[model samples]
Target: MKKIVVIALLIVITGYVFAAGKSEAGAGGAVEIKFAHYLAESHPAHDAALAFAKAVNERTDGIVTVTIFPNSMLGNSQELVEQTTNGALDLVIPTEPAIAKYVKKFNMVGAPFAFKDYAATDKLFAGDFIKWVTPDLEDVGLKYLARWEYGFRNYTTSVHQINTPADMQGLKIRTPPDFVNSATVKALGGVSQTIAFTELPMALKQGVVDGQENPIATILTNKMYETQKYLSMVNYTYNSTHLLMNIDKFKSLSAKQQKIILEEAEKAGLAMQKAVREKEADQIKELEAQGMEVAYPDTKPFITAAAPVYEELKAQVGEADFDYYMDLLGKSRR
Candidate 1:
């Protein structure tokens, strides 16, 4: 009788332990998310991303973990987008122009003189503008999380300084893979050469191109100053990068997890933007200290030269939407 009672108690304890183990497994399993970007680790955006991943992990109680692959370790912008679309990548951040190739609505952001300054551009993006165009991304299997800044695109060269459109005449300028960028270079009377970002330094060093255009932060972070002798504070174009996720992968997350990710991304993006704003002047000064000549030329001529691109892209974005964007800019300027 004593032996039978002991055996029964042992069986009951064993069953309870098994049930607890199953419950723990159901609650403690982690969801891993892979995020990729093409910026170096020193970039503000990269730092912000790591912070965001940490926030998400903590907020979700370690149920969601984000692993970031920076400096194009995953692939270039185009390949990253493709991978995200196919569900191989969970998240990706690509510049507006790169994404503009898939959704033309983004092209409006890259138009010359799109906004008076970074503040105005930031306002427009932080407002209803992004919501209006986000629907277009769904068709491409992407879900827009937030708009992050890539800073203002400036001109740099090993040959001569650019003060006006004529200054760029016959200059071979390396541009990103964007039609608007190429158009802007052409409008400035320079020949546009599209080169891979990874190969830009070699292109500039080898004299394959006389100059290139990118944000101040990008030029500094990439150490293009070593290859390029001059920096022009053209502020010719505003480069906006968008944080995105695979729609299916996002939808697969629990409602709570999705909310945390979106909220965290926005927080991270705003922090990164602030850091860029703070560092822009400092970075330019650092470039000068590094032996690159800096110039602030009259931008009126470049702005006037770039006017045609707006007209050309207006037809593509439709007159109504184009007008809407202008109206937004007008409000922001005031």
Candidate 2:
């Protein structure tokens, strides 16, 4: 299966390159880049990506143009990252957890209760954290361009209201295929089932899982509220989205082009963060209008329950790196 997938990927890449060359020749020598993400068009990430594309084209004066594939038109999160790593895709903005599969230190941020809140997260982003993570990425043929927000992940369940870790006992909850998410469910005493984001609605509708957790944007955009009965604001984790590109492809670009790409990516990320912050309350209200009950549960219990995850992940990522990150996260809160 791996060999078959590689062969298929090569074929796709070869075909795209050839077709892209011909199309660009016909389009008066404009370079074309493909950007992909797995989110609905209504998603803030999608809107931000479109803005990035527009800004790039305008700044480059039509010398370059970006074609975006939202909702995983090219592939799921894992496949997209792999494609970017192999230079088959030009860019992708995947969740930090997905990126953690390639770069282990990313797991620190993906771990449950990693950052105190968005402000702390921003402080880490503004500091030397990206520099610290760059070597791991460059070693794997990728480059981190910008950080976008995925907002705080909260619980939504059809089974019951979750005010404390005890309430989650024996409940089956869906999580993405990531260790932090699974460990979080285990710590809260729930059964963890890895489900693709695209299939989560059906999974919840058919009772395959009793509930799931995601940011409010995802819950509202994907209409998960339609299937889930309650939204619990436990703020168990913060979801972070990062723009990544093939390091080789980025280096191949002219210095000016590379600068434009990086600048536009940062702008897009900030735009996304602003949009998410401004729209969250409205999104929750929309979920309520869709018949979902929203609750702001006391999060101390959930935070206490997830404490072990920090030690477990720190051991996995190495004590030195873990301590460095903790120091950064700790200072960020102040």
Candidate 3:
């Protein structure tokens, strides 16, 4: 699918979406930051990004502003990240595994079963963990603003119960291009295919893949229920994401502008997160109403199947860093 660059589109949306004041964008006028992400408007992630935009505009008195494009309206996650690194797009929030392609060690952050829940994720984010991961991104030309939760990832399918690795034998499963996710499917004996988001709906309807795995919010927001049946709350991975900006462009910004931007982004992320946690049951109920069967498979079996994923991550990020992550996680549970 073609990328949806929101910077140009943001201009078009000014009169319609932003109302009267937005046409002032220019070389030295109000700086319009184009933010790109891959979540539908209805999803909490989009809600947070949009909230950040509104907050930035409000907090900065429009001198420093943000315009958000959700659901890859500014292109897919990869394209957005490239744009951000090139300073063409101001920001992009990418799933850590996708960002892993650029920042190798970051792949460890979202390995299958990485964090138990939001609390664990919050603790990791609040500490020095991300600082340790930042050095890896400097060489890649992108600045890691902060680590954000991608929410808890669950497994879903159109067929049988996936309580054990054997149950998934030979099933055609669609997964994101993350190595850990791909490996998990392979470990469980499924024929894993890395499919792009825009093409997933068609792929499902055409039976190109028997099932896919994603958070409840993603599955529902993407309307996968129309194409799939079984929803397994595997909680296999709490796929965290990173908000990134161009290294040079971020360095060029005034300290005040940078402060306002990141602080507002954090505010937006927190709001979005709280909303998702609150709406979890609602999303689950909607899926059931749509005739999709939802089940919380005994998670131990799924966790057991995911054991090797961590070791693989360790191999990528190094044992020291992997051990440090687990150590922090262990502390967080207490």
Candidate 4:
């Protein structure tokens, strides 16, 4: 009787230990990936993320599933990247400048007027840019997946219309905490004020800054039109959001799983680009209807004024990498 009781107790203890040791992969070995981004749910990026998640699930045959956290639910852009780097999160979508803080060469992407148009952007991305930058990301525990569109940034002001570089003088413009952004504003004669995106709407509403720059969709979706009275289609700099995954988390997947993720990421990124392009005209029209004045100043003067920014950036990002990027841009031009 004593032996029988001891055997039963041991069996219970063994079962409990096994249960506690089970991985978060859950039953049948399905892996759950956590993805977070700071874009609003109404934005095209959110839709693209959902499509990517769905495609991955189907392609992987349920072996992998993705869960999304939108609108800074997890944290702001920089915070999200930090979480991903530390393996606290599996994936994140952050702006190129945010990644530039970790990888200096990325600042080349912010070169004023680097891209002539959408076709040029397509060629740049389709070429060796990703291959060139992947190793830097891997060194920092990140895997570059794809580049999603953030569209060309434009200026919106409450105090004055920005028709030329001279018009920008002394105007306080809110910019992201990025050197290139601040440099661009300062080079064009505006006083650059650094602010986080999560705090921008309130900053604009409270008149913390006289004006700000963003894609039209952001202005419309975030209702910046309420606080801003003028919109200038400067198209000064094009920005893209990069999708990245934790390096270890990505490597742990099977070869086939890795292939599926890469393929789906590109497809979803294309979808996001398409959506933004399709909606841009209507978004501007809607903003106009909301009582905001729109300006289509000839960008030639603005581009010329921004020339010094390129040299400044080259000095910061190193001439070698900057020239390499310029070579790629030259090849990308049609």
Q: Provide the lowest-lDDT 10-residue window in model 3.
A: 18-27
lDDT for 22 (candidate 1): 45
- On residues 1-334, what C-alpha lDDT tens digit does candidate 4 reach at each position? 9999999999999998766434323333678899999989999999999999999999877768999999999888888998999999999988888898888888888788787677778899898988999999999999999898988899999998999999999999999888788999999999999988899999999999999998888888888999999999988888889899999998877667888899999999999999998999999999999999999999999899999999998888898999999999888884
For each candidate, what is the lDDT?
0.86, 0.88, 0.77, 0.89
Every candidate's CA RMSD:
4.3, 10.8, 10.7, 6.2
lDDT tens digits, residues 164-246, model 1? Answer: 88989999999978878899999889999999887888998899999999888889999998889988887888887889999
Tell me model 2's lDDT, rounded to 2 decimals.
0.88
Q: Distance (Å) between predicted and true CA of 104, model 4?
A: 1.3
Would you estimate the TM-scores of all the predictions?
A: 0.89, 0.90, 0.87, 0.90
Q: Which candidate is the best by lDDT?
A: 4
Best-to-worst ranking by lDDT: 4, 2, 1, 3
lDDT of each residue in 218-304, candidate 3, tens digit only = 889889989888887877777766778778766766666678777876676667677877888899999999988877777777778
Query: Pairing residues by index, what is the TM-score of model 3?
Result: 0.87
Question: Which residue runs does candidate 2 get wrong by more than 4 Å?
Answer: 1-29
- The positional error of residue 58 in candidate 4, measured at the CA in angstroms, is 2.8
* TM-score, cand. 2: 0.90
Candidate 2 local lDDT, 16-104, one digit each (tens)? 99876655433446678889999999999999999999999998778788999999788889889999999899999988788888988
Consecutive 10-residue window with the lowest summed lDDT within model 2: 21-30
